[model samples]
Target: MIEKELPLFPLNLVAYPGEELNLHIFEPRYRQLITECVNNNTTFGVPSYVLSKIEYGTEVRIVKLEKTYDDGRMDVRTVGMGIFKVLDFVSPWPGKLYAGGTVEMIKADHDGDVVLQEELFKLANDLFEWLGMEGLVKFDQKMLTYAIAHKIGLSKEQEYELLKTTSEKKRQEFLINYLKLTIPIVKQMEQAKDRIRQNGHFKHLDALDF
Candidate 1:
């Protein structure tokens, strides 16, 4: 396992590998962190929030950084694709929120058969259509996968489960299962909405039968 000390950023949200996270760095410390990353060409770790503790986060590379203010604030967009295991942490100050930790990178093996990826994309597309989001068909397969995964309603724990897997084949399988469960729920919700509309309960009526 490749290990190194990394800066930890705990967010209220969970970001999966191959997902995009846009952050507004306004705090002085984080702004400093961002500046150091941009200047040094380094990446940072983002641990998933779990039951009041953050143990896993994806290592993200900064794709674009835009200066939004003269006071060291930035509008930065990053893509997360690397998983890291937290080894140790230190919170030097009590009130300070950020902490530093040692991390080991978890490299994923993408050597799986391409046929599996193709089939997964097909299933994902079908799920999107079933959810009445056929408009997403225009997006590239990778983007479509990411979009659907975001909509799967996985909790932070479930997302961390996906993040920790090192095999592409297993990740695809998990995602297929998630799509199976989520697509039906979305369809049921849509059916309920259709029922409510067909009943005309929300429409203005000319008169009511007495």
Candidate 2:
């Protein structure tokens, strides 16, 4: 297990690799954390904040610092580097107002089976059309999972499961199953709405030949 010390930023959302997340740094502790990371050109870990505890998170690099307020607050942009598991948590590191911990990096399968990739792409494309989203998205191993994750209506728990998954093949299988289950339900809801719309409508009758 590889271990490294990293600053921790806890949030209510899951950050996937290759995805962009915007943050507003107003809290004094977090402001200090961000300042240190920016000045030293270091990266931080964002753990999934759930039920008042940190469970899973990804390492992110600050790509842009949009603004800095008069009171030391900041607006910044970060992109997910990859996922990591916290090995140890430190509430207050020495000489700092923030928290940090040691984490182990998770390996991801970059070149999963090509056949599985094509199958998942088809399912994602079909689901997108069902929801009337314009334009199809391109899929590859690195981004295929994250790109369609939220779009496929997976709950936070499900998304976390995907995050914890280390292999691309397993992630693709999970996505395929989620899509297959959800698409039918969505179609049924549309049919129900159609039925309600046709209720109480007047119908024209043609004369019958005697």
CA lDDT of each candidate?
Answer: 0.73, 0.84
Each model's TM-score? 0.79, 0.89
- Predicted structure 2, TM vs. truth: 0.89
Off by over 4 Å in 1: 93-98, 113-119, 137-148, 200-210
Residue 201 in model 2: lDDT: 94
Model 1, TM vs. native:
0.79
Query: Which one wins on TM-score?
Result: 2
Model 1 residue 137 lDDT? Answer: 54
Q: In model 2, what lDDT does residue 173 have? A: 91
Clashing pairs in 2: none
Write model 2 residue lDDT over 1-210, tens digit each, in one string.
567889998888788998888999999999999988999999999998754678679999999999999988899999999888988888887778888989898877655667877888888877777777738555444456766676677888888888888887788899989888988887788778888998899867798999
Instruction: Report the number of clashing residue pairs per model.
Output: 1, 0
